[model samples]
Every structure is written in C-alpha cells, then in structure tokens.
Target: MKKSILNLRLFNSQVHSRNVESKEKWLGYLFGPCGALLLNAIMATYLNVYYTDVLKLTAIWGGAFLVMFPLASKIIDAVTNVVMGYVIDRTRTKQGKARPWLLLSAPLVAISGILLFTVPNADLGVQAIWVTISYNLFYSFAFTIYNMSHNLMCPLSTRNTVQRGGLSVFNQISTIMMSGIVVALIFPMAIMPFLGVDKSKWILVMSFFSIVALPLTLLEYYFTKERVTEENVGKEEKKIPFLVQLKVVLSDKYMIIMLVYFLIYTIGTTLKNIGLVYYCNYVLGTYNDGVTQMLVSVIGGVPMGIGIFAVWPLAKKFGKKNVTVVGFLLYALGSAVCWMAPRSLPIVLAGQFIKNIGGLPCAYVFMALFADGLDHIEWKSGIRCDGMAMSLYNIIAVATVGIATAIFNALLSGAGYVAPELVDGVTVAAEQSKTVNDVITFSFVGLETITGLAMAGLLLFLTVEKTIGKKQQKIREYQKAEALARGEEWEEPEVKAAKEEEAFFVESEEIFRQELKLKCEKKGLNYDEELQKHIDKVSLKRKKEAEKKNKAKEKEELRLRRIEEKQREKSARLTPEQRGKKEEKARIRAERDEKKWQEELLKGEAYRAKIQAALAKRTK
Candidate 1:
C-alpha cells in the first residue's frame, strides 16, 4: 500500500513538471515579440504616412523617394535574406540556432528602428540618404534576423498538432494585443496628441518603443527552449546544401500554394492598413484629430478580439483549409460592401467589423499550415531545413511591406496628392480632388477584396492537412531509428505509444477488410472481383503519383550532375593549384551526396517493408 502511494506521488510530480515546462515554453512565445510586434504595427500602418505627410519627402521628391527607395531596397534585401538563412543553418550552439539570433537581434533591431523614425535635421538630399540607409538596416537586415528566428520557434517547439495549434493561437493573441494597443489606442490617443503631426516628435516616441523591446527579448530568450533543434545538432554535414534546400522547398506543391497565398494576403493587408488614415481623412471627411482613425481601429479590433478565440474552434470542426477558404470569402464580401458603402460612419464600421471577423482564422492559424508544409518537405526529401523555410517565409512577409508601400505611393502620386505644408505653427493638408478620394477608396477596399478572393482560390489547391498525420508518423519513426542507431538506453514513451497505436490501427483495418470479404463470400457475391477492382483503382492512383515524384527527383538530380560536370571540365583548364581547390570541393560534395543517398535508401527500404506487410495482411 505504501509503495502504491509513493508511485502515485511520483507520477503526479512528473506530470506537474511536464505541465510547467509546456506553460513556460508558451509564455516565452507570448512575451517574446510583444514590443517588436507593436513597433512593426506602427511601422506597417504609419511609416509611409510619416514619410509623405510629416517629413515632406513627397513634396521634395514627388513620390520618387517613396516608390523607388523601397523597391530598390527590397531587391538588395532579398539577397540578404538568403545569406542570413545560410548563416542560421550553419550556426550551432547550446542555446540553439534560432534562439541565439533572437538574442542578438534585440539591440540591432532597436537601434535601427529608432534611427528610421529619427531622420536627421538636414537638407532634402541628406535626409533621403539617411532614410535609405536606415530603412535598409532596420527592415532588410535587423528585422530579417529577428523575424526569421521568431518564426523558426514554432516548428522547433513541438511536433504535436494540437500543441502547435495552441501556440499559433497564443501567437495571434499576442500580435492582436500588441498591435491593438499601439495602433488602436496609443498612436491615436497619446502620440498623435502629444506630437500633433510634428515629425520631430516621432524620434521620442520611436525611442521609447525601441527601448521597451530589449527586455521583452530577454524574457523570450530565457523562457523558450529549442527541443527540436537540440535533436538536430551535430548533423550539420548531413544537411542538404542551400541550393538543394531551396529546390526541395520549391518542389512541394503545398509550399507553392502557401507562397502565393502569403503574397496576396500580405500585400492586401499592408495596403489597407497604410491607406486607412488617408481614407478617413480624404474620403470620409471626418478628420477630428485622429478620432476617426481610432474609431476605425476600435471597430475592427473588437471583432478581431472575439475572432482570436473563435477561430480555433471553427478550424477544429471544419478543417483548417475549409475554414480559411470560408473566412476569406466572407472577408472579400465585407470588403465589397465597404467599397460600395456610403460615407456613413456606422455603415463603414459595420463593414470593417465583418471583414475582421471573416479574416480571423487566416490571421492566426496559417502558421500551423506552414509548419505542416515543412513536415511535408521532410517526409518527401529526407531533410529538415527549418532555417531556409522560415527565411523564405520572412522574405515574403518583409518584401510585401516594401511592395505595398511602393504601390500605395505610386497610386497617391497618380491621384495628385499634394503633401501637407506646415504654416504658422499648424500643418495644413492640401485640398484633394475627387480622383484622389476615389483612389484611396479603391486602394483601401477594392484591392483587399480582390486579394482576399485570390487567396481563397489558391488555398483550394492545398492538400497538406490530409497527409500531415502520416508524415508526422513517418518522422517519428525516422527519429526513433536514429536514436536506436546512437545506442540510446531509453525510448521516449510518447514515440513508443504512437508507434504501437499505428500498428494497432493497421492490424484492425486489415481484419475488417478480411471480415467484409468473408461476409460477401457467404452472401454468394463476387467478393474477389469487387475487391480487385477497388485495389486496381487505388494502385493506379498511387502509381501515377509515384511516377510524378520520381520524374521531379530525377530532373533535379540531372540538373545537379550537369552543373558538376561543367565545373570539373572548367577546372581542367585552370592552373594546378586552382584545379586542386576545385577538385577538393567537388570531392566533399560527392561525399555528402553519397551519405544522403544511403540515408534515403534506408528510408525507402523501411517504407517498402511497411507497405508490403500491410499488403500481405490484406491479401490473406
């Protein structure tokens, strides 16, 4: 009796420890980006306004600065993204690849963000130079580092679907609260009033937010642990090269679907947010010291608040893809309503509320889908390149900000928007023509509606959710095999149970099929004929899919081989020393390729065995 009581106490203690650990990990995610996200919201929504309206850059350069600079910066920023991804993939430390970057990004991001708002008091040319330099440093470099690391934490957290879904929910909640507090409340109420449209006051406000981000980053670092990353450490040489990683990612049909969806959704959202202030001031004609802007935010935010709680349940019931499709359809409908809405406050607010509610599932739950995409890549390619995957995702996110800003500025320029001028201690905006108001309305409403519809259309092609369970199961089996190869003393209980559960399900399914065949036979039916027809159909479908995959694989391999052959031939014409270096690099690559081939072969054998066993059971 005493032994039983002691065992119960021990079990309770273990469970408590696990619960605490889980809670701590989530807390890290919740608090890590609190300050950073607030800063991002401010920049996304108002930075263009600051450049055009406040800094008078539009007056100086006539939209060239706004349009050309961001486009040019994005071109350079894309290369920087690839380099950062490579660095992250090669990095190894006790703190993990993603977390260390998170820690390092804090100060760099803070300093750059502050400087972006704090342009020097100088001539127009000097200001342009300063703005260009500072924007690249912050958005392209520092924020890239921070965001890529931030995104990687989701995949690194755990492989459990439910847990990942929960993390994504927490992530959305944090984003909503931080963005809501800054954009909805603080910017309109406190900062705008105190500064009253002065560009100089932006320096002080931005500085405050930058400083606040530092401690929050520290809290994130302390609370988060990279369990998935720990398992992947010391396998650097086994990783697919950067080019190969990119190929694998691009090969996945689901990743392509997500990429297109992200581009459309991001561009649409950015345009709407940036155009909101102009829409209120120019179209609605109710610019009461930022009150209209605040109201719009509040109206949109209320539905968003409810949506953060509502989306997960709806997704669980209807499936993530279906829920997303429905959400975007409703969002597009609401945007259409807004486009046709009268300039009435209540009507506009109602449209915005509907739009927010419709967009809730996509706003939060898509991260899990991206995680599922990574799992699919690993299952197909036998490699896990989290750094590369997250980097590409971040690039899409950051690039859209630049693209949206460029497009918005170009539209404003076309619409003949004259920059506001400061006169006699007050800034006065120029009177806009009807065309200008129309452009603002179209940008803020029509563009988003179109993009939302496009996203829904693209999501129809995504089928990852259907295969995620099997992919996860295969990943677990691979991990277990790796552990056994390393001669570990104990297996993880969760992994063991999962394997057992899978076996039981497979066995039960085989038994049920056999029973159905026997019942048909007893009923004097053509059991074998019907069974053969069903099997033949399934076999044909599987065969076609396998052929397509094999073709892609062979094409990629052929491309790689051609490139290598060309390099070798070119090296033969070089100096002895140069040829030696080239040959050495070639040798190293060959060895890595051989190792990868062997690993794939082993995995193929295991898969074939599993399939063969199931087939035999069914036939018997």
Candidate 2:
C-alpha cells in the first residue's frame, strides 16, 4: 500500500542518537511549546502597549485595572499551577501523562488566547470584566494546563542526562524563537507597524496564531513519548500522592536552588519583554517604525541561535553549573553596559547583544539542570517529583508573567506615561514624560542586572553535576530492587532492546497468540494442536532456509549428505505396499495443514484479531 502524504506514522517512529533523542521527537518538543506560547508571546510583547495605548485602558482610573488584574491572576495561578501538576501526575491515559494534556489543552489554549483580544464593545466596567475573565481563562486555567504539562515533558521524556539536555535546548529554542525572536523581533517590525491602535488588526493577528496552535500542539503530543512515565506503569507504588511528591521536592536542596534560579531568571526575561516596546517608543524614538527595536532584537537573537549548538557542548565540557554562573554574570555585565549609556541606541544594542550571549546557558540548559535536580530527588527519596517540581517550576514561570506585567503597568501608570492619540485621522504616539522614559529604561535594562546577579549567586550552591553520575547509578539500582521486589525482571534499556531484536516471540506477540487461542477455543477447535502445528511449520521453513544458504560448505557437509542418502536407501528397503501407506499418510497431513492455513488466510480472522489486539493495547 502506498503511504499517504501526511502519514503520521513517520512522525511517530523512534530515532535515537548517542546524545540527543529522535529527530521527530525533538522537533515535536521544539514546536509544542511554540503552539502553547505563540499567543503568550503576543501578550508578553504587545498586550501592555495594546492595553495602554490602543484600548486606552490606562486612561480609566490611571490603568489601575491593568496593574491590579494581572496581580490577581498571579494569586489564581499559584493555586492552578499546583493543582494542574497534581492532576497531570495522577492522570491515567494511553497517550501518557503529559502528552494527553498537551492535546487536551490545545483548543482551550487557542480559544482563550483569541478571546483575550476580543474585549466587548461596551462601557469601561464591561470591558474590564471581559478583560479580567479572558485574562484568567488564558493564564490561570488554559495556559496553566498547557505550560505545566509542556514543562513536565522534559523530566518525564528520558532519564539520560545528555538526551534531557538536548531536549531542554530544543524547549528553550522554541521559547526564544516564538516568544523572543519572532514575536519580539519580527512582529514589532512587520505586524505592529500595521496594527497601530487598530483593535480589529490585533484580533486578526491573534486569530492566525490561534488557528495554528491546535495542530502544532497535536504534533507535539504525537511525536513525543514519555519513556520515564511509562516505566512506572503497573509498579506496586504507581501513583505517588501529591503531598508525598511535594515533600520530596521540598526536601531536596538542589531542587530548591534550581527553582529559585529559574524564578529569578524568568522574572528578568518577563520584565524585558514587558518593557521592550515602551523602551522603543520613548527611549529610541521609534514608536511608529519598529526598526530600531527590531535591530536590537535581531542583534541579541544572533547569540541565541548560535547557542543551540554551543550551549550543550559548553555545559558538558565546563560543567553546567560553572558555565551557567558565567552566563549570568555576563548578563549582569551587559545590563550595566546598557545602563551606562541609556540614551545611545548603538550602546543599548551592543549591551543587548552581550546580554543575550550571556543568557544562552540559562535559556537553553536550565531544564537539563532542573532534570538533574529531579534525579537527585529520586535518588535521595525514591520518589520522582516530576509533577510537583514542574508545578512549582511553572508556578514561578507562569506567575512571573503576571507579576512582571503588573509591575510594568503599575510603574508606567505611576510615572504618568502618555498614550498615543488620534490626530487628523492618524493615530500618533504621544511624547512620554521624562519619568516614564526613566521607568521604561530601568524595567528594560536595570531589572535584568539585579536579577542576573541574584541568579548567579543562587547557582553557586548548585553542585548537582558533580554527583549526578553516582546519584543516577544509585537511582537505577533502587529501581531494580523495587522491580525485583514486585517479581518483575529488571534490565537496562539497551539490553532490553537487544533482546527484543533477537526474539521471534516477543511479549506482545505471545499476548496476541493467547487471544488467538481463546478465539480457537470459542469455535470448538483444538487450540493446542493448532498452535503446535503453526510452530512446527515455522521451524520447518527456517530449517529449509538455513540449509539452502549453507549448501556450498565443504567436506563434513558432503559426509552428512551421504549419510542422508543411506537413510533414504534404508527406507527404500521397505515393501512397496508399506511405502505406499507411508506416502499416503504424509500426503493426508500436508493436505490438512494446507487447508487450515488457506481457510485462516481467506477468513482473515487471525490477522484481524492480532491487529485489533495491538490497537486495543495502544489506546488502553
């Protein structure tokens, strides 16, 4: 049969390398976050500007709602992030724990994202209500589901540190490319120029992303596998209670450091995102043309693109901790450089470039480090806190989005920031007060400096890489003992793969045969006899093929052939009537076997049963 152009099987195949995972899987990992984050990118980069300048929401009560709502959403996020993680940990689905949620959350993520821009045309009170409802729906609920599950995929994908590192890189690249480069860079230059204060254009731009999100998430769900989660299936203690997982996570010192490092770094990035446009509008004097902002973004983005190939290698060689520390310090250095010449576009661009280069390790390798922390927890406590850890990781991550937004809004509002206005049919951005420009500069450049230094200090205590090897070894041994206690054979993944390759009757094949036996019994047929006959037939075919391939061998092979000839001569000594009866019995048996085989093939019952059984296991 010809394969279809859009064959999903190709995407589902497992491909492995010494360091990274399958090509298809990493691609899925790369794009899956892109799906969930596309709209998030818009919100992070443009929503504040939109709320203030376009919707003129800041005009109402000094933009108090803008500042207050995101802060309120963070409170909700604190609860939802934990609950979502706990739910994911307990979820039992055929697609694995995280992947199912990836699929389930896609539509919710899409719909909620579109609704965020669709503020109703009503009074200010009604608009506030719409914005609040839509904001919570996206951040507190829908995005929480997608983001937590997406973040959890790294730890649950594999136990191999190198592969996990590679996945982390892919995950970060997806984030930077969609949220940072594309949304922050291209959208500002291309889309935002056309979307100046037009409410409908914002909806149209968001809608395009909404349409693409569902398929991208589905791609992510299909291509990625949860090998680590699958390993826990049918275990004596399959489900670790949420409290137990939380306790395990909290008890680990490394885990706490990683979480803090992640939180501080995320806050810095969110602040930068929130303040970019304000910086462009007021400081660079490029509100109408986003060229200067785009140029600066592009300059910074170059290092990130290069970091994809460089970060893992550098981390592997220099130790993830040391490399990350250096990166964060460089981040601080870059921020200082920008602060020194806040009014110079060239200086700011240079500083941003330097800062992004410094940002590489944390941007790309944080998850690998976090996964190491999870391994440490598993080693120390014999419980994997993937769900709880990711919940907390995402709580810091998701909450920071709202926290930074609120902070930026409050700061701008307090600084007496001016919104653009319609003049002679063209919407023009208003000149901001000096206080507002200073506030924007600090948010964009100064906050990162403080956060970067803090993160670098926090990373000093993260010495996980030094002991990760020994810890992982102990974890394997612990798992082996647990498996043995449950009467299950424990084998390394490589060893198991080798055995599966060599075996004719694999576990799944035997299970299928058992079903065939039941089917035979239901028809009042002798299953044992049928099974034995099938085995004999397979053995005979294999023997014939082996002999045919070995026919050219010398000396002893000729001697055996003469002996076989002598056996035929001995049989020839029998009487004609005895030979006739023997031949007749052989002919009858061959005819009976052939008839049953043909009947089985013609009915297609055996293969149909086998396929159904396989499908049942896959979906179960």
Tell me the tens digit of each residue's lDDT in model 1 across 493-611: 45544464456556655876798699788898788776777678767975995697699779979988998999778877899998888779989998986686567557655654654
lDDT of 2 by residue, 1-620 (tens): 11242233333323232223455445677876687777777777887877888788986776788888888888898899899888877776545667667767889998988898999788988988898888889888988888888887888777888778888888888888886677867787888888888888888888888878888887777667676765665564545656667866776678888887878888888898888888877897668586877877887678888888898989987999999999989999999899889888888888988998998998889888888888776666666667788889888987888888888888888888888886765778778888999999998899899998999899999887776776677667767876788788898755653453346246435876798799898998888888887778878976985585577355659977998999799779989998889889989998986686556334433433443355446556
**What TM-score would each prediction reach against the true structure?**
0.76, 0.78
For each of the candidates, give the backbone clash count. Answer: 0, 0
Q: What is the Cα-based TM-score of model 1?
A: 0.76
Best by lDDT: 2
> Which residue segments of model 1 deviate by more than 4 Å?
1-26, 233-237, 485-490, 493-620
Question: Which residue pairs does candidate 2 place in steric collision?
Answer: none
TM-score, model 2 to reference: 0.78
Cα lDDT for residue 444, model 2?
88
Total clashes for model 1: 0
What lDDT is obtained when candidate 2 is compared to the true structure?
A: 0.78
